[model samples]
Target chain A: MSKSVRKKPAAPKKPVAPRKPAAGKKPVAAKKAAAVKAAGMAKQPDIAPLLTVSDIHTYYGDSHVLQGVSLDVKPGECVALLGRNGAGKTTTLRSIVSLTPVRRGHVGFDGLDITHSPTHRIIREGIGYVPEDRGIFSSLSVREHLDIALWAAKKPPERRDEVLKIFPRISERLEHFGQQLSGGEQQMLSIARALLAEPRLLILDEPSEGLAPIIVDEVRDTLARVKKTGTSILLVEQNVAMALALADRVVVLSQGMVQFTGTPAELEAQPDVKDTYLGIA
Target chain B: MTFFLFNLLNGLQLSMLIFLMAIGLTVIFGLMDILNLAHGAFYMAGAYFGYVVFQATGSFWIALAIAPLLPLVLGFLLQYFVLQPLIDRGRSAHLDMALLTFGLLFFTIGLIDLVFFETLGLTFMSIDKPAGLGSYVNIGTFYPSYRLFIIAVGLLVALIVWLLLERTVVGAVVRAGVDDREMVRAMGVNVYVVFASVFALGCGLAGLAGVIAGAELSINITMGVQILIPTLVVVVLGGLGSVKGCFFGSLIVGMTETLSQAYVPALALFATYLILAAMLVFRPQGFFGRTPKSV
Candidate 1:
């Protein structure tokens, strides 16, 4: 039933490589040797991506928004996904969390295939998402918002105090309704709420989208503190400088595919790619 | 003066009954965006359940205790089997759900009619007021003690509902859900379960109202349909989702209904409609309704 909803095409057949005479005959021993090699590969820091999205195709109704898009976030590292408007950056983050489910390809999280897992399951498996619009409940107070997330994550009550220490402005406006807060305060509350879940990976969509420059600096400082805690982050942002400043590596998306993936310095060296893909000179 | 006082008391009692009916309607509509036309069927089922329990147990208290449970269970079943599937089809399925529930309403009414009136040969059913509530109490004119008890129960239930929404974690989730369902789900809560539980709660309240109304007015198969229009008016007048609005809307409706019926018998039925039309013209969002924010 689930498969019917996905509309998957036939699985691609692997191309056979020229091999030694012993390779195809002794299948069991070959599988064992390959398993050993894979395990050995996992020990390498670059090989074991914490969150790997490989060639995921996603859609919004009939509109094919993300066409075979893929990226990776390594353990305890921050990777910013940068793109122009409608470049599928937000859809990439959404697909990882299965909010907009992938029609093809796999999403491996913490060494498990979670490509078809439900949104809540993805969240429970320690991925916190902060949506672009903030998604705050107008009727809920700041305290209630954090408390609900903590309750969902089954965190201790003291987690609230710890989160407050990180975002003191939220603490100051704890009793105020979510709609009452300014854009920066709401963003802080959103990030703080996601942090309380104690997720291994936090996915933030446009956290500095509409905030003032000073507020963006506060958010940057907060992200730096969060990075020090060793939680992997997948950030989707349009602010080129902010993305470059915080990201250890950057993935630039264009027309629903990965245009470039490298260190910020590597991206900085190529102004033509930036201008052509990101509309940045 | 005595006549005016009598009408006022009568209106107040009617208002409490309307509140019980409207409270559930507003919550279910608010949280799920489902316009359940079959809500009145639950009310009718409650009255019938109360009748059966009262007949078999020979106790009003026992009947009252068990009547609402039946509707709660029925609500869960309906939510799981019927409403859940429609909801999964997305926002466009709202009209389809309303039509489905409308069909459910008629089915329930038909089933009850066949079982009670056709099979059992009982034309109409009514439960006696509980022992202590049977007598009359004087407030310038004689009023039934059961009516006063209902008013008290209504106020108490309102307070309890208010507290539940304001002070509990479940209430916070519910309120958050009313504002943003996707956000609640992203927070790792199964919003479907929350929606089902809330739908059941609303259904139970409707049932309780039915059981109470059974004793006040005679229970007939057509009673659900008869009261559904007025109840919907109360819900809209109270601003669709606001409990406080339901309370005051019920009062205004009840008063208009009773006073207009008492003085100008010909316009009695139209009085509530007149007020509703006036509200639509002057304050389209209703008294307490805020304009919904686009997501």
Candidate 2:
């Protein structure tokens, strides 16, 4: 089944094969770390994961999705979760925010175990999510979107100018409703709304979807600026090149499980992982 | 011309009353997606409660101020404690909830029949206009001051609702919630609180409309079911979940009913149904509702 390789939107800069695990899984090491933290409860070392999801099993009714999936994001590191549609990338993100209830396993955020908390409560603990649909409120104006995000978060509009500066075009369209904006502008508004919450971890689900090439570059640039500010990003993208370009580490999903975890060069190296899991030929 | 002006005022007065009832119905349907058949019960309860308050205090103003609170508290408890949990727990589908409200409607009428008629030995009752609004004002013809006051209250409420939905931060949250409930929650807003607030506010308005209507017309045991038809017609004609649609829909229905009944007494509601049918045929989404997407 030689299908066409899904081309990269961003130039494939450091393409590599997948890193094979000749090594043990992370549970034993994670257990050791958890035990140490519980014993000493010392201040986190620089390497302590900011968002740690360990062996999470989620289901939609009887249909099992996200089977025993686990991953982590360290401080200021961008981890891209890549997969084909139905690979449960979105569910993984939803699980992190507790939007989709996890049937099994643990999700540690910063230090607290937040696996069973409500979506709103999980979000209030500092997670910003921009969903796949862009999640724009068609009746609300751009300014209203920004204001409502802050209002919901119960935070002052302190990041308004600073975040809006990254999205200059959105600043100009403050009065326009979500339906009136073009696709690129809507995506820009979506990202800007998330950034205004002053989240330490910003999770975006395919912000590049449905945008023109030039607009994708614009988004990429804005995201690059956001990443430079030391905000960790957990991005899910069908746009493999775009995800790889920004990601310090990549997790590839195939049939609700992690197929590979490596640097972009490592993902580009293993053509078989890209071919089998990512549907790249 | 005087006769025509008379129908016009009557139409306008009816429109304002329907608007008051329809606004509450629209937001609750829009926010909660609960097709609450019991909404008209709130209007009926409002009139009864207003009558009780008026009897106790001998002040129309006091009745107007206090009557809506009972329905408000009742609606809040119904939604916050009962309806929402059923939906959230996945125990009741929307159809189930709608059926539950239909059951609630019957239950309320039974209680109203028992308390207001059988027990209290009340006949078809009406509240007198307050001293301030007792006299008629000359507007083309002699229009009753109280009717004019209903129109004023209706417009004032419309303005206030518009401001709350469009200008305030809470309104923005509501508008956003209407579009995407889950997204609003993901943004860290507890939408249940918002839903419960809108439910309380909507029921309160219905109660207020009932009290106002009681002053103008006779309030009877069957008033709840009688008003339910017009209110439902207005809600459907305007489109579910839109305040603007409710206002305009109310005007259209109110005017059509009053004018047609006055002139074409034989037609009854043939003309109003014609317009509603035409609306259903040409633009099924109503004035402000989005066109339903095909499955």
Candidate 3:
């Protein structure tokens, strides 16, 4: 693999030649592998992507954060977006949801062009987003949070019970205000709220960003269970190990561009790419 | 002792009027982050609408029923046409909204004066109290039935507003938007719709306050300007977005104004300012406002 050469050399020319072939060869092989995997995924059905973010360029004010990021999430698949700080990982998620509008490129969700759609319309179109800060309403109770999500999504009352089952801790804190809940509990509530929306695709921005090891494991386990239920996920994560554990495919972003896209095993094999881009040795 | 009780009752009546005026202003400010100076214009419009409607129908009840709607429709039109376009332009647009509303306030005042004083040759008009509320009620000492009615209306409106904010999904979205607007929008709420509806509701309530207050006080061109400052004081003392805070703040300012007028007539105007200044020194976010988180 030309992984080592591609990792180094900020100079464009040296990496381009070796990078193109490796990047080109891997995806063709992965797609064939994915198709084979899709055939096995017949029981799950709808192996086609629930979301496709193609060549998106997003900006924050004057700063061009995401230059041209592209990735997709197949139905029931958990795709991990790995990146260093300032690598535009969060921007990618925001752009897809149109929280931060994409300056250019297409965001296709459930067979609709949502590139220019309002944030609410995209959410109504069934892409639930859990922000980096958790976006909790400080004054509202946990139950209120769940109720609002249900109301916004126009989901059934029964969905609240279903979501509560995934994070039983949230049920315990139903009466507690958002500000009163601990960080782990807040994360659980945030995830639970998003789940209650019955979204076709869930875009989580660093769900494991600031959590205890035990809590992270619990979230990972909950997400694994969620995957079993056939909801596609586009997750941005800094915890490389936890991400690798959950992701069916890993898309590594470096300075707002897709540097690598393949399976967890493929990523693990490319240690040089991980070390250079992910700061993981 | 009787004089003291009378002033206290008067203060309570004033407080209710202030509550009616301030609630809408605070909500509009909180949800949209727009300071609408022309909110007073809606109050003025409501009074004028009441006058015209009463003249046409010869019924105070009919005037009360129809007057608030005029401002409500005007508010919706103003939001849809004038303010909504500027909302997305950022903080600079807020300044623009304030200036635009100030201009609207003057424009509306001029319009009212022209229609009533020049066209109709009616100035310094007063709406007669409804037949049911015309007499005095001996509550502790002799309170006007109409004053008592205004207080009842105020409490009822407060309860309704509280229910809307605390119990409904729309309230939840509005409250959440006050905390984090982008998050509310990302949750798939058409925040623009929420903004428009809330702005209209606030204006409608202001109009209701105007019609009710116009019956008690003389309806004139300067009535809106006279009450606008005190209403702003009520909003500031209460908190930017908290309805519960606005209620209590209005009571405090209202009591302060009337009580000071009774005890130290010279300080009535200055006392509210003194209290506000003191509050600012101690609690800048207002009585119920949360301390802003340093980002």
Per residue, candidate 1 scores C-alpha lDDT tens digits across A165-265 of 88888999989998899999999989998888888889999999899999999998899889878788899998889888998767778888777766676
Q: Over 4 Å off in model 1, which ranges?
A: A1-47
Once fitted onto the true fold, the runs of candidate 3 whose alpha carbons sit more than 4 angstroms away are A1-48, B91-93, B291-295
Interface Cα root-mean-square deviation for all models: 1.9, 3.6, 2.6
- Residue-pair clashes per candidate: 0, 10, 1
lDDT for residue B102 in candidate 2, whole number 0-100 = 83
lDDT (10s digit) by residue, model 3, range B1-295: 8789888888989998889889988888877777888889999989889988988888989998999998888888888767877665443466787899989999999998898899989888988889989998886788789988988988999999999999998998888877778888878778877888888888888888888888899999998888888888887898887899999999999999999999999998699999999988988788897642200
Clashing pairs in 2: A16-A265, A16-A266, A16-A267, A16-A268, A16-A269, A17-A266, A17-A268, A17-A269, A17-A270, A18-A270
Worst 10 residues of 3 chain B by lDDT: B286-295
Cα error, residue B265 of model 3, in Å, equals 1.6
Give all TM-scores, in the order shown: 0.90, 0.89, 0.90
What do the candidate models score in CA lDDT, each in turn? 0.81, 0.82, 0.81
In DockQ terms, which candidate is top?
Answer: 1
Model 2 ranges with Cα > 4 A deviation? A1-46, B291-295
Q: Chain A vs. true chain A, TM-score per candidate?
A: 0.84, 0.84, 0.84
What is candidate 1's lDDT per residue for B87-139, written digit by digit as tens? 76564366887898999999999999899999999977899999889999888
lDDT of 3 by residue, A1-281 (tens): 21211222122211111111212211211221222233223322334456777778888888989987767777667889998999999989989988787888888876677888888899987788999999888988788888888888888889899778778788888888889988888888888888887887888999987899999998899888887777878899999898999887788888888777766766778888788899987
Candidate 3, residue A272: how far the Cα is off, in Å: 2.7
